[model samples]
Structure formats: C-alpha cells, structure tokens
Target: MRLQDKVAIVTGAGSGMGRSIALRYAKEGAKLVVADLNLAAAQTVVDEIRDAGGEAIAIEVDVSDRVRAQSMVDAAAHAFGKLDVLVNSAGVGNIIPFLDTTEEDWDFVFDINCKGVLWCSQAAARRMIEQGRGGKIINLASQAGRRGEALVLAYCASKACVISMTQSMALALAPYQINVNAIAPGVVDTPFWDRVDAQFATLLGLERGEPKRRAVAAIPLGRIEQPEDVTGAAVFLASSDSDYMTQQTLNVDGGNWPG
Candidate 1:
C-alpha cells in the first residue's frame, strides 16, 4: 500500500470525483477524513470505506467557509494525529454565457472553486508545517481553465485561478517540503452532465440531452471519462512516486484541450 498509515483529507467527498478519490486513498491504506457539504453523503462514503475494511470518518463541511475548513483540518489531526495529504475536490460549474453571467454567479463559482481551495490549503499547510514533514496538496482544476469556455466563463476563470494557486503554493511551501499541484480533468461522466443537459436545454430552447450528446461527440476520446480514470493519476501524485513533482497541472482529459 503506497499510502499505508497515512492521513488524508478529501473535500467534496460526498460524490463524483471527490468520493472516488477518497475511496482510492482508503484502499491504499490511508485513514481518510471525508468532508462534504452534505453530512449524509459524507456518511455514506464513510460507510463504504468501513465496509471495505478501511478506516475513515465523514464530516459535514462547506469548504468555502474558512472556519469550517479549518475545523476539518483540526478534526483530521485529532483523529489521525497528523495530516499528510489534502485534496481540494469541491467545486461548482456554471454554463451561462459571459454577458449574462451575473456578479452573483461569478462570486459563487469563485468562492466554492477558488476560495475553497485557498481555505483548505491554508488549514492543511498549517498542520503540515507544524509536523515538520513534507505534505501533498492536490487541487482539482479543469480543461476549461486551459482553454476558456465561453458559456462557462466564471467556472473557467475559477479553475484557472486554481492552477495558478498551485504554482504559487508549491513555490512558497517548497522549503517546508510541502508539494502543491493540480489536476485538470476534462469531461467526466457524472450527474454533473445531467444537470448541465437540463440547464442547457432550457437555456437554448432545445430538446433535453441534445447539448450533452453533442459535447460527447466533440471529445476525441468518443466517450466521457469515468471517475475511476482520475484515481490512478491522483494515487501517483499523493504517493512517494511524485516526490519531485510540484507546481504542475497534470491533465487527465482523454486528449481533450491538448496543448
């Protein structure tokens, strides 16, 4: 087990990529702190991990809240005696055109996507620094960040901020042996798309699911990525295998948004 006896904190662990990453970490022998906005959802993940013979605890948290984010770190330290990894996976997506994107919309996106990362990373870095051992911070970025999406202006901007923050954090924490990096995932098959399909249908006056199908066909991979597709890269980054890696954004987009 690459992460044997390690302590990991995964935000947004209620579902989707966050839930998958939490499960993956637990399978590798890491004791998990699964935090999410929904208490029940987090509990479900905790139950799943326990059923698999892994140690985990679920906490309800809103990453956008600094107090709640710090409390999450405090809880993890209390349970596992230390914090080794912090994965910022909580985020929101928006698909409104740039002109129509209200200030409220932009604020919501940035608060949950970028500010949430800031709060969690800050809280986790404090613990890691106190422990005097290196740590890992993996943030969830997006292909939309690399190539701006017109309809998802706020979301793209927020993820772009995440990528930049990863670089800045890596440089600042290098002396402390803490590595900060990000993963820019492309289209993944999740309930997110179902919501997007419905929203886009209403926005465009088109039949439901039409935009989704078109988006899928546009991807070179010919299919949306599954949550599992992201776990392998995450495991590598969180493990000793990536000791020399930092300040990087690894894209797991099935060839989408190629440079």
Candidate 2:
C-alpha cells in the first residue's frame, strides 16, 4: 500500500511493461487510468485490476497526439479527482541499418517515443502542478540510448530523447515538487520482440529467433528480461521511496548497459 489513495495514469498500459506497471500500482492501492491505443487491451487490464478489488478505468489514446494526450489527463482527473503519477511507456522501434534508416522511420519512432512523452508529461505535469503537491513521472528509456546500435538508429535516437527530456522536465518541475525519471530497460521479451525479430530477420538476414537468441546470449544475467522485471523500478519511482530522486535513469536491464 505504498501508493495508498494515490491516482496514476499509465500510458501503453495495454501490454508488456506498461501493463505490469499498472497492475503493480493498483496492488499498491493506487487508482489507475490505463491508457493505450488498443482499447480492448487496456480494458483487459482494467478488468484484471477490478477483479482484484482495485479501482481502474481504461481509455483509448494515441500518446503522440497532443490534444489526445491532454484529454487523457483531463479524463483521469475527472474520473479519479487528482493525478499523482504518470508513466509514459508507449513506444516503437525498427531495426533497419543506419544507412537504410529513413526520415519516415525516424518520425514514426520519435513521434511515439519522444513527442508522445512530451505531450503526456506536459498534460500530466499541468495537473500535478495545479494539485500543489509533488508527483512522479516515469518514462521508458532503453539501453540503446546509452550507446548507439547500428541496427536501430531511429529507435536509439528517440530513447536518447527520452533521457534528455526526463532531465529537462526534472529541472523544470523541481520547483513545483514534481519528480521526473526514466527506466532504461534492455532486451525485454514482450510482444514487441515480434516486431524486432521480424525487422532483424529482414535487415540482418537472420532467422526469426536468431536475433533474439543472440540478444539473450549477451545478457549477463543469464535470462531475457520480462515485463515484470521492470515493475519494481516503476513502483519505487511512483511511490514515496523515490521522492528525493529525479532526472535519473535507472537501469533495469539485468546488468546490461550498467551505465
């Protein structure tokens, strides 16, 4: 019950890490607003939380849209009365080689990964500032952002933006007692990997699971990352435990990208 009586909005809560974070927050006594582009998936999470005796609602949202992102914040405040935490997890990645990366590829990834974070954070921060109490903003970064991967140039750049924005938001909102932070996850085995695997197969001339096999083999922890592996870091950030921390990117990558 670390988040007792708190209200939280988790973007991309439909699946993977976002879904895990939403459920974890609910378990901590926080009312949740599960936002995702997939209404059905978001509702599934809502059902899970409600079945567990926790309060939650689902909304369909494209975080890349500023107006839609603001509406999401408005809906949360309307439904739950106040917002205490925001987790931006909606993102995309492509595995084209650096030379093959196109402007459209960059736009697609950045729109959701970077621009989406900005829009959602802005909307959430406005509500938190008006509440006159501190709030937590957790963004999803990636190990790729700490360095560059030739195969995912656009994605790497976008996540770097996540880290940069986290720092900027932290400094800007510190005066208002709002904390902005990020979790840099690595090699998670979510449905997202299907896309990554397919892209790698096409671009790297590898088999469907070969790219993933190589990734898993490289993990120092001896296992691929799971969505649940990221929940603890998120729970800490959303709870009072991380009140003194901000503008920091916690590596939940199982010893990968230790930086």
Candidate 3:
C-alpha cells in the first residue's frame, strides 16, 4: 500500500471528488477521517471503506467553523494517534453574474470555500507541528482562480484566495518540513456539478446536462473529468513523491486553462 499506516483527513468526503479521494486513500492503506457536512453521507463512506477492509471514521464537520475544524483534528488524532495528511476538499460554487450577486452569496462562498480552508489547514498544521512528523496539506482550488470565468464571481475570488493562501502556507510550514499545495481543476463529472448546472439551467436556456455536455465538448481531452482522475494527483501530493513540491496549484483540467 502506498500510504500504509498514514492517517488522512479528507473533507467533503460524502460525495463527488472528495469521496473519491477518501476511498483512494483508504485503498492505499491509510486510516481515514471521512468528513462531510452531512452525517449520513460521511458514514456511508466510512462503511464502504470498512467493508473493503480499510480503517476509517466518519465525522460531520462544517469546515467554516474554526472550533469544529479544530475538534475534527482532535478526533482524528485521538483515533489514529497522528495525522499525516489533510485534504481541504469541502467547498461550494456560485454561478451568478456579478451584477446579480448579493452580499450573502459572496459571504457564503468565502466562508465555506476560503475561510473553511484556513480553519482546516491551521488546525491540522498545529497538530502536525505537535507531532513533529511533518505533514501534507492539499487545497482544492479551481481554474476560475487562475483567471476569470464568465460568471461565478464569488467562487472565482474565493478560489484565487485559496491559491494565494496555499503559497503562504507552504512558506510558513516549510520550516517544519510540511508541504502545502493546491489543485485547480476545470470541470469534473461530479454530483456537485450536476447541482451547479441545475442552479443555472434556466438562465442558460438549457438543462443541467446540456451545459455539462457543452463543457465536456470544450475540453481538449474530448471528455469531462472523473473524480478518480484527480485521485492520482491527490495521492502524489499527499505522499513523499511530492515532498520537494510546495506552494503550487497544479491544473488538472485536461488542458482547459492553457495559460
């Protein structure tokens, strides 16, 4: 197993990309903390991992809450004695145009997408420092962060913040031998995308699936991304293979963002 004996915390593990990364980690022999805002969903992942003979625990956490994030780290440490990896995968997206956006919309995006990352990274880094074993922190950024998109102002700004924060975190944690990185994915075939598409289908004059079809057509790879497509990158960053790499946002969008 590539991650034998490692303990990892994967937020938003209930569904979509987060769930895939959590399952991949478990299969690689890592003891996992499958965290999600939805308790039942998280538990389902835990059950799946356990059934597959992997060790895992499910925790319901609203990552935007600093205290809750800290408690999550405490729970992980209490369960497995140490935390070797932290994947900040819990996030939400907004597709509204800038003119139609509201304060609540902006705050909501920042709170969960940006501030959530800060809370989780801080909490995990503290534990890693205490353990003196070093650690890996991976943030889920987006192509929107690299450059502006047609809509989704709040989401774009928040992801840009994540990219900046990843760089800052890598610098601060480097002295401790901890590596920090971010993944900027364009579009993936996930449940979250279905939800996002549903939200704006009316405005686009098409259904959720139509927009996704168009997105896939736009990708140079001739297909939209799958959750597993990102797991390879996640494992790389979380393992020693990427020990020398930090403070970088690797685009996993199948050449959608050429810049």
Candidate 4:
C-alpha cells in the first residue's frame, strides 16, 4: 500500500482518469474524497471503494468555483482529519477550429480545465501548509499541451495553462514540502471522446468515429490509452517515491509524443 495512511482528494472522480486514479488510490490504502460535478456518479465511486473495504466520501462540486473548491478541501480535512494528496483531474475540452474559437468557448474550457486546477490547488496547498506535512498535488495535463493542434485550439491552450501552472505552483509550494507535478495523458479511450469526436465529425467533415480511429492509429504504442495506464504515474507522484521531484509535467502518452 504505497499510499497507506494518506488522505487524498481526487476531483473528477466520477469517471474517466479521475475515477481510475480514485480507485487505484483506494486500493493503495488512501482515504479518498471523491469530488465531482455529478453527485450520483461520485457516490457510486464511494460505494465501490467502501465495498472494497476502503474509506471514502463523495462530494458533488464544481471545481471552478473558488468557494466550492475551498469547501472541497474543507470537507476532506473534516472527514479524514488531514489531507495528503490532491489530483486535479477535472477538465473539459472542445474541438473548435482556430477561427471558430470564441471568448466564451475559451472561458468555458479554461474555467474548468485551467482555472479549476488553480482554485483547487490553492485551497489544498493552504491546508497542507497548515497541517505542516509534505503533500502531493498532481494536475491533469494533455499531450495537446505539448504542441498546438489545428482543430482543438482552446483545449490545447488550456492544457498548456495547466502545465504552466504546475511549474509555478511547484516552485512556490516547494518550501511547504508539497510536490506539484502533472500527468500529460494522450488519447485515452473514454466517454470524453464522444463529445470531441462528434464535434470533429462536423468540423473536419469526417465520418463519426473516424477521428478517434485516426488518433489511435497515430499512437506509436498502437492503441488508445486507458485510464488505468495513467494511475501508475499518479501513484508514484503522490507517494514518497517522487518526493524529490517537482515542477515537472511527465508525459504518460504511450509514445504518442516524446518529451
């Protein structure tokens, strides 16, 4: 149990990579606060963890809201008595063409994917500082952040923001012994693709699913990434294994892009 005795708050824990990390953290013996926008999905995750004899609580929250974000941290500290780790895995994406991108589109994407990370990490870091113990703050980035994409302009920029924030936060929080890092996942085959692919179908004039097929075929690993593929990296970052590492955004993209 790498994370035994640790208490972690995982945003977006209702599904996708967040869910995978939550379940993985529970198995490794972390008390989890499963926070998500969907109450039912979050509760279901808590139920699964409890069924496995793990400790967890589900909290429905929109991480973009600063107040709610602080409350999420408060809930974690209140429920578990201490907070040791935070995985800012909550995000949203869109595939609008460069010219089609709007102020609203950028705001919508950044509010959740970038600003949400900011709100949550600030609150968690404050608590960690008060607790006087080292902690881990892992942000969810994307391969798209490493390079610009024609069709997904806003998403690319937002993830790039996440990476930038990871660095700034890591540098700033290091004195408090909090290691801030990020996981840049590539093409993970999850419900997330449904919305992106559907938008690409109309934007790129491709048949439905063709965009995803192309994405998978481009991966040097020869397959789409799964949520489980990223948990190992998360576990390492959240555990003492990566105590000396900070201000780094590790690429867990299965060779889709080499950093």
Candidate 5:
C-alpha cells in the first residue's frame, strides 16, 4: 500500500501500459481517475478496479485539448479532493520514412504524445501547487527516444521531447517539492506494438511479426518486455519512494539502449 490514500490520474488508462499502471495504483490503495480518449474503455478499467474493491472513476479526455485537459484535472480534484500523481501515458505513433512523413502524421503523433503531455502536466501541476503538498508526474518515454529510427521519425522525436520535457518540468516544479520523472521502455508486447509491427511489416517487406522478433532478439535480456515490466518503476516514481528523485529517465528497456 505504498500509495495509500493518494489520488492519481492515469491518461490512456484504457489500454496497454496506462491501463496496467492504473490497475496497479488502485491495488496499492490509490483512488484513481482512469482518463482516456475512449470513455468506454476507461469505464471498463474502472469497473475492474471497483470489482477488486478499489476506488476509481473514469473520464474521457483529449489531452491535447487544453480545455479538456484542464477539465480533466478539475474532474479529478472534484472527485477525490486533490491531485497527488499524474501519469501522462496517452500517445500515438506511425511508421513512415523520413521523407514520407507528412505534417499531418507529425501533428497526429505530437498532438497526443507531446502537446498532450504538456497540457495535462500543466493542469496537474497547477492543481498540485494549489494543494501545497507536492506531487508526482511520470511520463512514458521510449527507447526510441534515445535514438533515431528510419521508419519512426515523428514518434522518436516526440518521445525525445518527452524526456527533455521531463527534465525541464522537474526543474520548474522543484520549488514546490514536486518530482517529475520518466520511464523509457523498450519493445513491450502491447496492442500498440501490434500496430507498430503491422506498419513495419508493410514498410520493410517482412512478415507480420518479423520486426518485433528482431527487436526481442536484440534485447540482452532475451525477452520482449511487458506492460507489467514497467509497473514497478511507475509505482516508484508515483510514490514516496522517489521523493528525492527528479529530472531522471529510468530505462526499463532490458539493456536495449545504453542510456
């Protein structure tokens, strides 16, 4: 019960890493705001938490929309009295060559991955500051952020921005005792990767799972990662365990990236 009585909002809680983190937080005794673009999906996660005897609520939000982002914070605060932790996990990506990348593609990815984090963190930090008790903001970066890839230019850049923004946010919010950190996960076996694998397959002229197979083989740990593999770090960042830590990006990448 490391997070007993804490209030947390997990964006993209409808699926993948975000859903896993939300469920874990609820089990650790935190009241959760399972925010996602898909209201139905978020409600499903909320239902699971309730069935497990944990407290949670679901909200639909487009994090890139400043108004919706602010309303999300307001809803969380209104639900549980205050904000304690915010996990910016809503994101999108596409596989395209550098030259083939269009502005629409870039904006589609950046809107959710970059601008979304900014708006949500801004709203959350404002509420946390008003609460006068410090808070935690955990972002989901990617090993792709550590290096450029031929087929994922926009996504890579967006995640790299997340890492940079994490550092800047840690500095900006340190005066309020808020800790900001990020997790850079490697190739996790999530539904998101299913889309990525398909895109890679079409682009590289390989089989449906070949790109992912190669990625897993390259991991020194000898396995593909899972959403659960990242939960421990997420929990640490969201709880008192990381009170003295900030501006750091922990690599949950199984030695995929040397950072």
Candidate 6:
C-alpha cells in the first residue's frame, strides 16, 4: 500500500495506460478519480475499482477546457478530502506524413496532448499548494518525443512538448514540494495503437499489423509492450518512492530510445 490514503486523479482512465494506472492506484490504497472524455467509459473503470473493494469515482472532463479542468479538481476534493496525485494521461495522435499534416491535425493532437496536460496540471498543482501537502504529477510522454518520425510529426512534437513541460513544471512547482515527472513509453499494445496501426497500414501500403510488428521487432525487450508494463512506473511516480525526483522523463521504452 505505497499510496495508502492518497487521492489520485488519472485522466483518460477509461482505457489503455490511464485505466491501468487508476486500477493499480486503487489497489495500492489510493482513492481514485477515474476521469475521461467519455463518461461511460470512466464509469466502467470506476465500477471495476469498486468491485475490487477499492474507493473510486468517475469524472467526465475535457482536460483542454480550463473550466472543466478546474471543476475536475474541485470534484476530486469534494469527493475525497484532498488531492495527492494527478496522472495526465489523456492524449491523441494521428499518422500523417509531415508534408500532409494540417493545422487541424496539429491542433487536435496538441489540444489534448499538450494543452490538456497543462490545464489539468495547473488545476491539480493549485489544489495541492492550497492543501500545503506536497503532491505528485506524473505525465505521459513517449519515445516518439525523443525522436522525430516520418509519419508522426504532430504527435511527436506534442509529446516532446510534454517532456519539456514536465521539466518546466517540476521547476515551477518545486517550491511547493510538488514533484512533476513524466514517463516515455514505447509501442504498447493498446487501442490507441490499433488506430495507429490502421493508419500506418493505409499510408504505407503494408499489412494491417505490419507497422506494429516492425515496431515490436525493434524493441530490445523482444516483445511488444502492454498497458501493464507501464503501470509500475506510474505507481512509483505517484507514490512517496519518487519524493526526491522531479523533472525527469523516464524511458520506459525497452531500450527503444537512448537518452
């Protein structure tokens, strides 16, 4: 119970890495706010946590909306007693060639991946500062952030922003003892990747799974990553284990990218 009695909000907790982190936090004795753009999906995760005898509530939020983001923090404090951790996991991406990338593509991805994170972290940090209890903010970056890809310009840039933002946030929030860090995951087998794989297949004239296959083949771990593979790092970041750590973007990419 590394996170016993902690209150944590995990954005995009309806699915993939976010959902996994929420469930794991609950098991570790943290009360959870399972938030997602899709209320129903968030509720499903909340139900799962309750069924496992963990405390949790579902919240629907568009993290890019500052009002909604503020309300989300208010709701968490209202439901529980205080805020202790926030995992900014809500994000989006598209597989567009660099030349073909449009402003819409950039906005759609950046709005969620970057702006969303900013709003939520701001809201969460404010609450934490008011509470006077040092807290944790864990962001989801990507191996893609470390390098540019031929077909993922917007997404790559957005994640790179996340990493940079994490560093800046860590510095800004350090005065209040709020640790801000990020995890850069590699190719995980999640629904998000399903969309990515489909787009890559269509764009490159390859088989449906070919792009993903090639990605997995390149992982030094010798296997495709799973949502669960990232939960351990998420848990550590959210708990007291990382109290002395801040502004670090950890590579959870199975040696896919070197620092």
Task: Tell me the spans in candidate 4 whose CA falls farther than 4 Å from its real position.
Answer: none
- 105-135 per-residue lDDT for model 2 (tens digits): 8899999999999999999999999999989
Candidate 5: regions farther than 4 A off: none
lDDT string for model 4 (1-259, tens) is 9999899999999999999999999999999999999989999999999999999999999999999999999999999899999999989998888998899999999999988999999999999999998899999999999999998899999999999999999999999999999999999977797888888888888999999998888999898899999999999999999999999999998898878
Tens digits of per-residue lDDT for model 5 on 103-159?
A: 899999999999999999999999999999999999999998999998899999999
Winner on lDDT between 4 and 5 is: 5
Per-residue lDDT tens digits of candidate 6, residues 1-259? 8999999999999999999999999999999999999999999999999999999999999999999999999999999989999999999989999999988999999999999999999999999999998999999999999999999999999999999999999999999999999999999889999999999999999999999999899999899889999999999999888999999999998899979
- Score every model by TM-score: 0.98, 0.99, 0.98, 0.99, 0.99, 0.99
lDDT of 1 by residue, 1-259 (tens): 9999989999999989999999999999999999999999999999999999999999999999999999999999999899999999998886899899999999999999999999999999999999998999999999988967777889889988999999999999999999998998887877776787788888889899898888878888888889888999899889999999999999998888776
Worst 10 residues of 5 by lDDT: 143-152
Q: Which residue pairs in model 2 clash with each other?
A: none
Q: Which run of 10 residues does model 3 get worst, by summed lDDT?
A: 199-208
Q: Would you list the C-alpha lDDT of every candidate in the order shown? A: 0.92, 0.94, 0.93, 0.95, 0.96, 0.96
Which ten contiguous residues of candidate 2 have the minimum total lDDT?
A: 198-207
Clashing pairs in 1: none
Give the count of colliding residue pairs in each prediction.
Answer: 0, 0, 0, 0, 0, 0
- Sort the predicted structures by lDDT, highest score first: 5, 6, 4, 2, 3, 1
Quick one: how many clashes does candidate 1 have? Answer: 0
Please list the Cα RMSD from the true structure of every candidate, rounded to 1 decimal place: 0.9, 0.7, 0.9, 0.7, 0.6, 0.6
Best by lDDT: 5
| List of clashing residue pairs for candidate 4 | none
Score candidate 2 by lDDT: 0.94
**lDDT comparing candidate 5 with the true structure:** 0.96
